[model samples]
Target: MMIFEKVKSAIDMKTVAEGYGLHIDRGGMTLCPFHNEKTPSAKIYGDNFHCFGCGEHHDVIGFTQKLFQLNKPIDFVKKLNTDSGLNIDIEKTPTKTDISEYQKRVNEQKTYREYEKNAWQILCDYLWLMREWKKRIPASPDDDLDGRFVYALHHFDYAE
Candidate 1:
């Protein structure tokens, strides 16, 4: 396998960020080292980082390169290997089973991420609908309140 591929496959960005003294919260966010900010804007994924505030985006090696002001990616790779003790065998060739396992892992991660995003979006939409329902008050004292409003009253807090 190539050095770049081997390095990326072995080392996760969270480890790199943590090793460099960046504290990642439960949401995988940290105060961006690239810029000064009161709140954490950089989202660290397994492979990369994206800063919502400054529009800075980079993969693991790119991040390390920028963080250290290195001239070349190879230099960053070397640092990652030697300093981080990743111990990725740069010249090792992947077997068929190794390739299949890696692909399977990648696919599973992609599927899980998609499911998580979809679920979060669905919950947010449901919350909004419940809030809208709660606003539907009856105009007359004798009239019955909207059932949706009652449902919202019962479930909004719990759902939230």
Candidate 2:
């Protein structure tokens, strides 16, 4: 979906841009981010915003991606369209580049998710085994008696 379409359909363009640190003032105009400016020459016209200071104007999706230096404009568009109540028509057909990149991302994300799931399962199984072993074998005097075993396990597993 085009950013223009998304922005034009949404009502809270200025609020959304402000949430991204654009600092809209004087009816959604702010200092241009593309160039150094003391005065606010930027203007937001309904869904689209423009900066006369640097002559940069685009829809909210473009503004968001440029402001945050996102890698993909599509990613930002998808996010904004999904989160900010901007409805978009689904593409009837996908292009080759879109299909290929989406497939690659699906494969990578699947592998990563599977790895995480397996790792979590392994830890859970290990904890069950440990609990069983502990039931079978009484705690020793030298064993650290603090109930921090689960906390330590969680910290080690998820503290990325």
Candidate 3:
């Protein structure tokens, strides 16, 4: 079944109204949220509501859409799926462009993560090597300093 049909069949208008913080009396009547009113003019039915004061009639989906001021009906469908735990599958088949764009973004993120990982590994190796070279001190003060030790002394701070 389509998402809208399934949702309408699975949910009641009164349940939806109450879920969104509207108070319903024993008669399933509540003050209309669409307009200011002191008396309860809207009557909630099984899958629809009718407002006597403003003449506003809407089904479950329409009521949710209007209640949230959402631009698209599908937005309310998603919200209903989450809030009501309907577990309805609402995804449409992706087009070629959509698949390609998704793959492109995934590839870009993967490439960036790999580069970051490799850079961090290289920096850690260089730092460890510099520390080892620092241990290679000359045997005597007059002895010639090892080139690697000299390089380690100069570049240890930069490597760190």
Candidate 4:
């Protein structure tokens, strides 16, 4: 079994949350920590938790990671092993291939972000030009330029 499966089998999310001092009711409900709520909106299941108030959902490992701000999954696993006295073996060092793949994914995300930024800028500029044209163009019922401009503006407004 993988490390994730081992951790999941070893840890109960409800117990972990209780260890953090969050009061969980017998019905498996608690006040959501991620958001402000008068009533219990976070529900804990056998393997995971979901908050209806903030929509925060995660397994046991993810719960600990978010709660303690651990940087990586391995870090969380190590912490869990230490705290729970589990003998799950995990590699302490990542391979070169792993580092390369991580860097590639990071680069791809950066490129996608740049593309989205440029696309939004272009859309905003086009919307501005359409507004300026609407101001300069005279109101003519026969010509549908005004109507088309209005439609374009509405489309871009929602798209942005």
Q: Once model 2 is optimally superposed onto the true structure by TM-score, how far is the C-alpha of residue 40 displaced, in angstroms?
A: 0.9
Model 2, 123-158: lDDT tens digits are 887667555444443268777654545454445444
> In model 4, which regions exceed 4 Å deviation?
87-160
The runs of at least 3 residues in candidate 2 whose Cα sits more than 4 Å from the true structure, single-residue gaps closed, are 1-8, 81-160
Q: What TM-score does candidate 1 get on C-alpha atoms? A: 0.56
Clash total of candidate 2: 0
Residue 70 error, candidate 3, Å: 1.2
Q: Could you tell me which residue pairs clash in candidate 1?
A: none
For candidate 1, write residues 1-160 as lDDT tens digits: 7878876776678867876879889999999999999999999998899899999999888988999999987889888766555544456777667656655654565567569869999999999999999999888888998899989999999989
What CA RMSD would you report for each candidate?
8.1, 13.0, 18.1, 13.1
TM-score for each of the candidates: 0.56, 0.43, 0.55, 0.51
Give candidate 1's error at residue 66 in angstroms.
0.5
Q: Which regions of candidate 3 deviate over 4 angstroms?
A: 92-160
Residue pairs whose backbone atoms clash in candidate 2: none
Worst 10 residues of 1 by lDDT: 101-110
What TM-score would you give candidate 4 relative to the actual structure?
0.51
In the range 1-160, model 4's lDDT, one tens digit per residue, is 5677666665677656765678888899998887889999999997788998899998889888887889988898778656644444565344555445534544564467569869989988977776665464436766656665666556655644
Instruction: Name model 1 segments beyond 4 Å from true.
Output: 89-160
The CA lDDT of each predicted structure is 0.82, 0.61, 0.80, 0.71
